[model samples]
Target chain A: MRNYQEILDTLIDVSKHPLRQVKEFKARTGHKAIGCFPEYVPSELVYAAGMFPVGLWGGSVENSRAKEYVPAFCCYVLMSDLEYGLNGTYKDIDAVIIPSLCDTLKCLGQNFKVAVPSIKHIQFTYPQMRKIEAGVTFLESEYGRVLAALEEICGTKVTDKAISEAINVFNDNRRALRRFVGLASEHTDVITPVIRHAVIKSGFFMEKPQHTALVNELCDALSALPVSKKGKRVLLTGIMADDDAMLNILTDNGLAIAVDDLAQETRQFRYDVPSEGGSAMHRLAMWWQIFEGCSLAYDPEKKRIDMILEDVDKYDAKGVIVCMMKFCDPEEYDYPLLKDALEKKGVPCLYMEIDQKAEAQAQTRIQAFSEIL
Target chain B: MYTIGIDIGSTACKAVALKDGKEIVGSSIIQTGTGTSGPGRVYEDVFKAAGLMPEGVSRIVVTGYGRLTFEKADNQISELSCHAKGVHFLMPQARTIIDIGGQDAKALKLSPAGTLTGFVMNDKCAAGTGRFLDVMAKILEVDVGELAELSSRSTERISISNVCTVFAESEVISQLAAGKKREDIAAGIHMSVANRVAGLARRVGIEPDVVLTGGVAQNLGVIRAMSEILEMNILPAPMPQLTGALGAAIFAYDEAIKLK
Candidate 1:
């Protein structure tokens, strides 16, 4: 029997250094890797092109040069990514795909093109008028452009069958991840919040099918065990929760993440591509249209509150924690509204400001919030 | 029985002891000089003032930025929770709180019972904090404690719109070089901090009877600016620096009784 510790340790290492993982995947498989920035970017097209869709959720990098291109008010993730791209850290990527989701992202997309001249940037906008035929129609056209861009960069013709297969692989991967999140919370002793994040984040570095296989195995190992720990089960919502420091603090405070609405984690996989839709490209576009509840992705009706309330109930979570990303306009704008609605329902929510540096203040905040829970 | 709480802000450390969980027996506030020794020094100082032995304390709770490092604490709470708890205990009618400490500023809304309803903290910047004013005071060759008085005497208030502390400092220097009065520049700094904090308060939807705590609560200039901007009378805690420690002591007492 494979030890879960060994498996998780190996995966955590993979998730920690995505650039090295991408280079390794490229060297081992003799294939190219494409960069996908945070929030939403349809990686299925890249996967269908027989390439790795490497997630570029920013890290602790030197932001000195990034200031030359973008303002300091941008989110930490974008700043780090800009720093890497400008400094040639991401020079090896064949093409970078950016989803111009919010204001900062839109500016970053333009800056990336000018700064990283060597890499091809496949930029597309996700329609905010989703939930309507017009939105789907616009997104389908956008997907077509992205498909063409991928074909141009990869110098290979991607077929309908290949995309359909890629969609199936992603759907299965999403199911496994969705299942494993619940299992991780149940078996917090075995799968701490850090370990769970590692297991989920590693998927962005590997092929979708391979990720699915590993997650299924992890779920099996977790389910075979008893509830090894007891604590407050809470839902985490934010752009990203990849900070190991923050996760360790949560563990110390005895708060288990029952599930997350983080864009870097479950939020990326929540909506599976609909197979009943027209073409694989259409289905991929339909996936974006059907997606809801992210601070990004534009919901005029603000259904995220309902989704969060529903998630708390469904997961039997005691409360919600907002890993508030620093300088993220969309998330910042939604915070007051989200808090107001949560207050009305008498639900407890705590906001922790996340940034590049790990401050000692976060520990006290997390501990205090956990006490109330 | 005695209950103790220690608060470690970025600039200073505070210790407070409560007897029977009602009256504050004693409190001490001093700079967080160097390392692990600050908590111990403040602890001893508070104990000496109370004329009590530390061994008799029923429980000890710690809150603030350095609370996690205070190993002697029986319980640790967030500065946000501690501030709310302390203000609730100090001024029972305080439904909102604005606390400006060493590293950051926060505006927290509370229930009539003093429970924290919601809060908005400063972004990852030093502008809306005591540290921001300290740097500006140093630049102007003035003591930080005297900034409120200096600004109050300003004939005309200048505008310091930059939110970044480093930029704000440079802007202040240029303004001085551009023949701007130090008092007016000081007033601008106060307005800048006040506006930033007031924006945070509005985000949390300030309720009536707001209480102000932390080191900045003692600054009358900031208080005046906050009043003008928030358009509400912001009350200050009698000993704003020890509020977090007091709140922790309250929690320590409550938890101690429950355990017994």
Candidate 2:
């Protein structure tokens, strides 16, 4: 128990101060580090290029400087990333890889390129028709483009075998993360929502292998405990739900997160990159093809709600709580429809806006939802 | 046994004491003060009015933005659920409830039994809330309480379309400089708030017997504008601001009965 607490506490500290982790990783490994934006990016390629891929999900920062480049209507995640770029917060990093997954991100790439000329910016647009063979071809081209940009920074040739090895390591990390999420739901008393988020989020900063090992140990420790009856079982959905304030509120209200469809968490790892394909680049592109039912990705039938219901039944959740990030239109567009679909089937739900800053009202919303359950 | 429910809102605090879970024996509304101590102040005021002390209450359920901060609350509920329940109790026919409070605007769908079936809330912006009305009233040099009457007297309607409170204030300043009439702009501000809230209500599918609760429901101008925009008669709760407190009181009564 002492050993597990030490390991989890260290990882949570790393999540709290990301720049410290970046400096430590650079000093410890003597390897170069680069930044990768959230939702989906070809981090495996960066790993193959002999550099750590630091995930940038934009922490709680009061930034008005980003408004000079982007509108206030843009999501805080994108705006905060832009703010970090302009404010020299990420100046120590070599380069940044921005994926044009949504409209805000698409525009962010251009703004970063024009505004921050010091850091090299690599941008790529994922194929919208990602379920077809041609989509596979398109993704391969995109990965190849990013790979070339990475090679220029690493000053090393990224061979197919290097990428293949990187894929195995990342696949291990993903599997371990999925395992921890499942284990944490049963032992929420030990793994609290904030700790669960920290353990998952710390994976973004650490090397893929070390992260998996720590989580794999945490999972082993938690597997021995009986199911915790500390909180109500509920599923979370939306862009990102790592807001510590909201997590604490859930803890106070006795709401245990049974599962989630958040872009920053399970949505990123719900599948793995197929190891066998034309090349490592093609396999990297294939991850996008297998992805579906996310607000960021295009799903013509809009089947996200059905997938959420599946989690609800699987986790035996009483209801769903959507931590809708403020100013995110893509997620906003889906809420009414998702609510209608869930309620028609007798599933209950609560909607609370997750802004960058915490407010008492958001806490009340969570408390009320839990009270009803 | 008497049960109590208290709601500490952003701008005001309201509480209700119920007898036998069906009658409102005592109720009080007061402006919110600083910190986690506001709910207790309103609770005392209500208890005195009800001719009962804290010992007489069997259960206490608190709801609203400041709910968790209330130290004496036995249970905490959400303003959305509370409003839905309060409206259902006030008007049984209400299937949809729209609440515009100090800093939020929400649309909640309720079953006939008053359970929250579906709902939606504005995303951290104050354009459609009571705070926006207060700011607009400040700009128009009229009391916030009187602007509702002034808005109703406008001869020609003006439109204020910005959905951000800060930007809307600037737009109002520009309109004032542009020689727009105060009554017209006041009417436009109410219409803008109405239009924004009406959008949220429609998304939740506004059914007949739509009830309005919270502080903004007291403004006749917003209710009139919403009635025009939604093309349905808007039913205001008897004491709109107290509905959340009343709902909490109902929950307290239910909890006490279950314990028995």
Alpha carbon deviation, residue A110, candidate 1 (Å): 4.0
lDDT (Cα, tens digit) per residue for candidate 1, span A1-373: 4677777877888887788888888889888889998878888899999889998887887699989988877889999988988888897788889988998889999999998888888899888788888999899898889889998877899998999999999899999998988788678777878888899999988878778888888778777788764678888998888788989988899898888889888888887999776888888888877888888878888898788889888887887898889888889888888787777877789888888866556776677678667
lDDT of 2: 0.86
C-alpha TM-scores of all predictions: 0.91, 0.91
Summarize candidate 1's per-residue lDDT along B1-260 as a digit string, tens digits: 89988898888999899999999888898887326578789978988878888688899998888776778889778878888888888889999899999888988888887887777777668988999999999999999999999998999979997478999998999999999999999999999999888988887788889878999999999999999888888888888988889999998999999999
Model 1 chain A weakest 10-residue run by lDDT: A357-366
lDDT of each: 0.86, 0.86
**For model 2, what is the error of residue B149's alpha carbon versus the real structure, in angstroms, after optimal superposition?**
3.7
- Candidate topping DockQ: 2
Note the residue pairs that clash in candidate 1. none
Question: Can you tell me which runs of candidate 1 are displaced by over 4 Å?
Answer: A128-138, A152-155, B32-37, B139-142, B149-155, B167-189
Q: Give the docking tier of candidate 2.
A: medium
Q: What is the interface RMSD of candidate 1, in Å?
A: 2.3
